[model samples]
Target: MAAIERYEQWMARLLLFNKPYGVLSQFTDRGSPTARPTLSDFVPVKGVYPAGRLDRDSEGLLLLCDDGRLQARISDPRFKMPKTYLVQVEGDPGEENLEPLRKGVRLKDGMTLPAEATRIEDPGLWLRDPPIRERKSIPDNWLKITIREGRNRQVRRMTAAIGFPTLRLVRWSIGDWTVAGIAPGEFKEISV
Candidate 1:
């Protein structure tokens, strides 16, 4: 293969990363006073960038790609790409409490598109680095929440809106790609 062809092949790669808690989605933490872990620490592959962000406090599947169009499709709201999450909320909410999320939760930004939300058994994920605080008197519930809109902290806010605040959040999948076997701070590459 020609040098240019090799470069193009490299650029067409897609990476599915299992982002651990407290890691920034970007390559660097330029503005923060304190240095923090970022993609550069986990992903050494050059050229690829995260398609969408998973907040520093949140963890799980994050797609990275060097192809701009593919990145846009995964991150852009117009594409309506479904992103699934395994959430641990502060209270034990019943199906009635999750209805609003399925119908569309009104957020400060606006009403979100209806989501696929359901209570789920513990997903048996690896332990979080710091671990979530446990309240003896209060119970937490696990939920499988899938949303098409990529809003900032949307899942956490939605749960709060329904009177159940999120204690922990993990992105399980985006479209057909999933974090199924990828361990924290690890990544797998796929061709576009």
Candidate 2:
């Protein structure tokens, strides 16, 4: 048995997982016609659950907690934890393209909170499977954007509004945790 087995009934522990694309956040999905494994396929804890959810279409760092209290603390927007994303947009994002993001873009739902930081590039990156389509005439660029809120498809929408559609989106980090060193569909326990 694992060391964590002994503490199952008592203390709660935090774990970091690298959630790969196309995996659902829930343990079971009766609605789907086909079978696809959930976090259970990667994590074998009984009481543990994801703190926050990454969409089935999105991929990146995910936090799970064995304790309900700790789960609430991390998932709650009240905590205001920052999430950083490395986005590949459909076109070159110039200085002008970043201003609205830094200042805060007004989405149809509401005004998005300003990003903590926005940079033009991140040299350390990898190509995506089923690579984003290329428009021979139009070039694309990468942007590392960090924001506190996790609105549904917010990054994709924001970039599209700024005249640069999002070709791909990946959450690189959340709070103090990151997806570094872990490959796709792989996960490792992180000390909180």
Candidate 3:
């Protein structure tokens, strides 16, 4: 194939990555002593960039697109694509504890839109490394929260506002793609 044709073919591709904890979303981090390997370390694709960022402390699925148009479509709030997270909180979240999340919790930055769905439990999940601090006097609960917006640290902030601070946050799915069968630091390409 001609170089131009090959380039065009590559631009149409997309990849899903299960970002492990401590990795940066960007390719470089100014030689920071604590910088973790980024997508560039795993994906050799030249034009791809993350559709949205997952903080270094958070672990989960991250989407990348070689096509600039497709990246914008997936990342832009205008598209209104939803993202789901499995969050482990520090306190036992009761049905009442979920009311504010369902009703749309108000944060200092702004009122987060009500979660599309909220569940107090999810069966399949892995424990986080350097496990979250445990309080012998208190208990913790797990919640599966789905939201349309990818606000910065939104899940952690939302849970904390309700008095149950988040111990760990993991993005379980994004739009139609999921982290199923993919382990941390692994990735695969899929049709969008």
Candidate 4:
């Protein structure tokens, strides 16, 4: 029975965490002068690490797992797992403005692969803490952007490259798993 329990513990485990804004994706704050909220604040499960990084400011679905192979499959750009984001940008953009994103924008790193970009109605997600800054003069627009590669701050950079700066960014899904039904700072575990 003890051996069976141990075997079960070693079995692949996955967690879908609804990462909130301003929270770091890592488990610890490391050497930061000021302590910042991290996964440890929300997820108490041991041995699990984030499969891919979500920037401190970005909110939404963040995958954590105990298996290294599973982590690599999710995080590795080579796997080309599609990551989709619901982005609110500063200005209302027409299809022409989003064309650059669909065709792949050239960044300082290199040309990105073409992505699926579309203007979307507000997804009406939960209100973010502290809220996004609002400008009465400029209208904001929502976009559903899906990309296969996980680049550092890629979505924000992509929108900016096309003349619309993202005001708020929420990662809605990573492949089949999504942030749906999970509230901020909460996580659901699953066995793989």
Candidate 5:
């Protein structure tokens, strides 16, 4: 490797954290009546910030970095890095129900780019502490969704637009990275 490249790699730190539900994506809380948990509570590493955000209600792969270029490459939508999600919607969503998401949906923010979506088997995941509400009449379905754009609450909105509200959402992968081995509130560091 070139000297500059070597130096950059030596300085770059990438951390893949499996963010738990109810934990804020940020390190600090500006203001809130309740004392919600934040990333700082779990991540001991200093000088690193989340490359992108996973809403407090969502769970799974969250990437953090101290390197500016690496952060931008992963967070910027222009890069078209795919983010895969394992979504559990409120009702059974067959292939026909997911077509609009694949074609793209129009939101108040504007039209979203097309997504790669498919039905998936039930993911035997760790239970959330409080747990999602159980409505006896409403059935649930699982879908694996891949979208390149990272918009605020995009996945939830997309599923809602298709008439299948997301009950539980888990981000399984981002680009070439996956949250396979990490458990909630735990992280693994990698140097690249």
Candidate 6:
């Protein structure tokens, strides 16, 4: 492809990343004594940046865009775009235990917006390189959760507050986009 062709192509699309565990969502490395892997490591595409963040510990679908307006639309809570997650909790939290989360669980920061919570079967998503530890005696359960707001460690805090600590958290979808076809450390750009 021509240089201008490639530039235009790179500038006008959405890049979906299935961010692996331990990778920073940003393009630049900030302040770790050891060099942590970043989105830049996998996505060499220029101009586009992550629209939202997925903590270094969390994994799954992360969106990137060169268009600032589209980035705002995806990341702003006021837009009420849905972000869904498949969360594994430390214990078997019955449906009733999740009622508080659905009703907006209060946290140190404040009450979260009411969200969608449902006990679900294992999503059969990709395995983490370093898997979550298993305690044979303690049971674990999965949940399909969708929240509109993005807070720091929000999913983990919500589950912990309700007495079921989070084990593994994977963002399954954002708005209509999903990590359904992407694999860890890989990414693809799609037309808006």
Per-residue lDDT of model 4, residues 23-124, tens digit only: 999989989999999999999999899999999999999999989999999999999999999999999899999899999999999999999999999999
- Candidate 2's TM-score reads 0.87
Ten-residue segment with the worst summed lDDT in candidate 4?
6-15
Name the regions of candidate 4 deviating beyond 4 angstroms: 1-10
Q: Can you tell me which runs of candidate 2 are displaced by over 4 Å?
A: 1-11
**Per-residue lDDT value at 178 in model 2:** 87
Q: Give the per-residue lDDT digits (tens) of candidate 3, residues 68-95.
A: 7888887887787889988888877777
Q: Give candidate 6's total backbone clashes.
A: 0
Q: What is every candidate's alpha-carbon RMSD to the true fold?
A: 1.9, 3.2, 2.7, 1.7, 2.2, 2.9
> lDDT (0-100) at residue 75 of candidate 1?
96
122-173 per-residue lDDT for model 2 (tens digits)? 5466555656688899988888888888788888888887888887778888
Q: Report how far off residue 97 is in candidate 3 (Å).
A: 1.4
Ten contiguous residues minimizing lDDT sum, candidate 2: 116-125
Per-candidate TM-score against the hidden true structure: 0.95, 0.87, 0.88, 0.95, 0.94, 0.93
Query: Which ranges in model 1 have alpha carbons more than 4 Å from their true place?
Result: 1-11
| Candidate 3 residue pairs in clash (backbone atoms < 3 Å) | none
lDDT of 6: 0.92
Angstrom error of the Cα, residue 128, model 4: value is 0.9
Candidate 3 wrongly placed segments (more than 4 Å) = 1-11, 31-34
lDDT of 5: 0.93
When 3 and 5 are scored with lDDT, the better candidate is 5
- Candidate closer to the true structure by lDDT (higher is better), 2 or 4: 4
lDDT of 5 by residue, 1-192 (tens): 599887876788999999999899999988898888999999999999999999989999999999899999999999999999999899888889889998999988999999999998888898887798878998888899999999999999999999999889999999999999898989999987
